[model samples]
Target chain A: MDFQTILILAQDAITNSAIYALLALALILVFGVTRVIFVAQGEFVSYGALTLASLQTGVMPGTVWLLLILAFIAACMETARLLVSGARHKLPGALATILAPPLAIAALVKICTPLHLHLGWQLILTMLIVIPLGPLIYRVAFRPLADATVLVLLIAAVAVHFVLVGLGLLFFGAEGVRTPPFSDAQFTFANLNVSGQSLCVYATTIVFVAIMAWFFNKTLYGKALRAVAFNRNGARLVGITPHLAGTFSFALASAIGCLSGLLIGPITTLYYDSGFLIGLKGFVGAIVGGMASYPIAAAGALMVGFSESFSSFWLSGYKDVVVFTMIIPVLLWRSLTTAHYEEEE
Target chain B: MKQFLASISMLAVLAAGTAAQADITIGVNLSSTGPAASLGIAEKNAISFGPSVIAGQKVHYVIYDDATDTTTAVQNVKRLVSENKVDVLIGPTTSPTSAAVIEAVAASKTPMIQLSPGPATISATDEKRKWIFSAPANTTIYGTAMINHMVKKGVKTVSVIAVDDAYGEVSTAAYKTLSEPKGIKTLTIEKYKRTDTSATAQVLHAMQGNPDAIFIASSGTPAALPHVALIERGYKGKIYQSGGAANAEFLRVGGKALEGSFMLAPPVVVGEQLPDGYPTKAEALKFIKAYEAKFGPRSMFASLAWDALKIVEAAVPKALKKGKPGSEKFRVALRDAIEGTKGLKGAGSVFSMSATDHSGVNQLGMSLMKVENGKWKLEDHAEFK
Candidate 1:
């Protein structure tokens, strides 16, 4: 009720919204281009947070091993495909593609983690280790079933989520881990003080959003992605590779998820399973946006964050109910207003 | 030749029966790999230190992982009773799982020692709790210790925020029962689910009451959310946490935000820091040393398990005088012997059980601890006034 209290609540809402916005953006991007719900989007978040935590302790994270394994598997699949197609010359290139990045990343991690490198480099290393897992997952799980029904792809995504969660537990253990804040400074504005971490969240979110917007509107690759999202068959007819678009979308989404995890890690202790609930919140945001418009999805995510913050004040026990219930009216309105169309077989 | 073969078979049967009677089986069902795995793993480690022989009888342990699910715990208790035919049952770590196994233990009339820090509601009265006993101090002791500290500090009003689970509900109820009679007004009470990421709304609502203190009744890493939010909102009042949050993981996750927060924990948490004359200090230190030597650090749940085993060790000799180790009569004798425990100091607390009270430890065994510089420090005295 007081001015200061309201300001504090607003700050909390903004910090939470910033993270949710990134998740929503990632979800929408992957779903748009790939037509997959990407339920395992949150696993990348956990991976990112835990990877940083491991690096902070001056130990090489098991994530590097996971990356190597996934990359090797993806490479084998590609090699097998080339061999089956009788493309003998491309087999060596395929092998190189599968083997090089993971090995280089593993070597870099091995050298830097023991040195107790600065937090900035550790964060970058964490991101580098986690981001490629996205495309590798897509290649191994989703791409093979690309011609399958959307329902089948969604089930596969759920399966991936379970596998990643199990793997997360094996790597991180049952205990939750928290990292030190990026900046320990506090800024005072008369009656209010804001942590530097909150500022970082806001700044990073804004920058990433702007970068994504520019990329989607201006770049050739981005335009091609938009084309595939618009109509996959039509984009293929125009010589744009659908597979390339899917891989790019998945990679970008994974990066967004990792960044969100890094930003939120200092604020809360993260376990292997923490990402699913957080990602589900973003899914709620995506639904409010009708799963199509990026700006609207971001706005919806902020709404969710604010509603959760304020509702926890008004009805602490039912805040989750309140936040999740917001979707009901949106769903009802969309059902009544939007046209229903069935996809062609 | 046929008569000789029959005699040999009869001898084999008698020998097997004698071996089973001489070996006393203690079944341990714990949450070793689930949401409560951290606590369960600690309990498992402590129970490992139990004696291999008790009262001149071989003690054999049969351990099962319940994964913190109530259904699994119940199933494990059935298997331990019907299949293993164990003479005693040790655990199922968290309060809910412990509560779930009560019926199974009671049905089999098996003596069970639970290691959860909650009220022994599985059997409320002396007659009903004949087969059940708990190791940790009751939830009411935590409430009394906290409220006594509050009243000493001249705190007249407080607000409550707890997780909406069995542990949270019991602790909050106990706090309410103890605080209100002492003229401490509870301005508001709020609840959140266990896995919630933020408690901003709860903190804000609690702040509106403008109480002198705030008691958060959640446990583990999630317990840090409200404290972090409270500090961020600049609400500087006394913050109290329940015993469930008395683990090192809470501090590691909470960081500087939890500094100066008060909690009522068993003495084992601050064993090295306890006064020399403290009754539980020597025993607590011994267990801590042995545990840390093996597991890197001693946890509250581990201490509770160690204490439970101590109670068993103390009761076994008394029970043995009444009947043989494997008989139904021996199980009854063990239950009676445990109930008769008085002033027996163990790792976490001193036990003094009676027929009416299955949870024998009280506020005397609990110490007031405050988080200082991200570590628990024992307050020399509870008299803040």
Candidate 2:
């Protein structure tokens, strides 16, 4: 290939890698603190994209209603628990917590949707609508089973994925929707011309990664989360609440997933089920990183993007097969190198 | 007195059963809620406009959603044949689903009219296609038209990029077959999955060949990926697309990147732009007006479905003369009547079905369209062979 061709192909790989990196990081964060393989990480991506699509059309998305319902259920569960324990004072607080956010969000959506806000504000609102479902779902489905084995948690994750997919169909129909690009400029350098959307994707990914690095290294909450990941029982004994860490981790992962979806929406037409395949690609990257190291996961995701791009050039029909087959070698190397240990009852 | 009442009741029950059997049923299996739902929805809307009464028999439609799944499509066909006992069947909107249910339709001896492009293998011989008829023009006719246009333009080398699916495989193969015989060199062939977000590598690889033109064989919004990639990379060669991209949705998603691209589409796509002497122009315009009035827009798939129902409408009266619609004898007569269709002008084409040719629409049924100013316009210089 010529130098220009090679450069263009590399650009494609880097753009894809940026999206995959976000997904890989989300997977690692959720799996580390919660010990759950989040199979439905992709569903969050679709929800975010479709939510933006609805908002663009000036309609109140079904996601807003879903969030309201889930929050109400979670609040009711907490309230019921407090009442059963005869903690009458906490019941009022529980009710307030459960009822306030949905009411506020609903009112905001009701007022702003018809005004047809700018794309930037619509995207922000979409993220705000989607991010809380992460923690609410945890409280309703996963928190009760926090002490269960990883296998059971994995199955629950798969079930959650199906529910989200079905809900996605209901919200967004089966037709694919494409969001407007953040910018419409085109930059030409020598023989290559780059779209403004690609530049936005790169800048956003870099900024988010840097911010995450600072958060994990400098913040107290981040340290608490690390402590939880290191040893849940020990963290609990040290006065760090494992439940808080779980909620925080899921909330962060879901935010990252939603951000990735927003970034990708303008670049491609996305259907309700598109997220599963994209998330599977991210899972491959996470697997390569051993699901622990953020930097390694990011690098692995870049490798996946590069491999997919080059394989499409060389063996176009088998590019997906090639990228997916990469997991086999990484698995073999890990199985041979890492020591196995049983959990203590 | 009790015996007399029982005998009268039995006679009434028999009469009711006979009346029910006399009603003609048209079974419809479509992907109403899956990846191909847009096409299926449009087709469903078109079929709803079908005549409610034909040949003094009340026409009843039994519709099922296959969700674009192969197994579900086959199951729907079986149920329609065994349970509904439909005299005629239409659709399962996508090509893969349509192809999957062929054997069941044939085994049940029911006449089926598919609303999408299918492979020649499903109707390669008269015996194979005895009970099946395709509504749209064959893929080969589209390929031949495109290749003929290129050959006339003095193009020598071409590259192809297609989705790695049945539709892509069939259309690309047809292009190669037609182009090769006409002394055009196929430089390279590349494939990608329909869900792929980027086509940079495929486009870059095709650019290496430096062909005169590139053909993209894909459907819906997926068709825009390669076109955008090629334009961004500054490859200025001609781009041609398959008939599947002939829809407003494709144009809406593609935007300015699709400008200057050429496509082979059924004449119904540019019905208003057809020449005054065109045979199917009046019928096409009438159908387009009715469809757009009801659905707000006319799509190529909707027109295909409209034509499929029309073909069935024309054959019903002839079949009614042989036997009542519920009987197997009537179904056989209907199949034969459809096979004998000649010079019938519908929305998409002038269909001429014969014993050996189930896909009766030929090259004349197609028109070359150019994407100009974000819309499909008829190319005046298009030569029909």
Error of 1 at A94 (Å): 1.7
Q: Which parts of model 1 are misplaced by more than 4 Å?
A: B1-20, B124-129, B193-195, B380-385
lDDT by residue (B351-378, candidate 1, tens digit) is 9998777889866578889989888899
Error of 1 at B15 (Å): 7.2
lDDT tens readout by residue for model 1, A68-149 = 9998889889988998999999888778877898899999999898898888988899999999899889999999987788
**Per-residue lDDT of candidate 2, residues B1-385 (tens digit):** 9999999999999988887889999999988877788889989999888999987888999999998899999999999999999999999787788778878998899999988766553463656467888888878889888887898788899999998888898888888778888999988999987767788899999988689999999977778878877887778989999987787767876878899999889888899999876878888999999999999888888888889888999999999999998899999999999998898989888899887788798776888889999988997324433
Chain B vs. true chain B: TM-score per candidate = 0.92, 0.92
Supply candidate 2's per-residue lDDT for B352.
91
- Model 1 chain A: weakest 10-residue lDDT segment is A336-345
Model 1 - which docking category?
medium
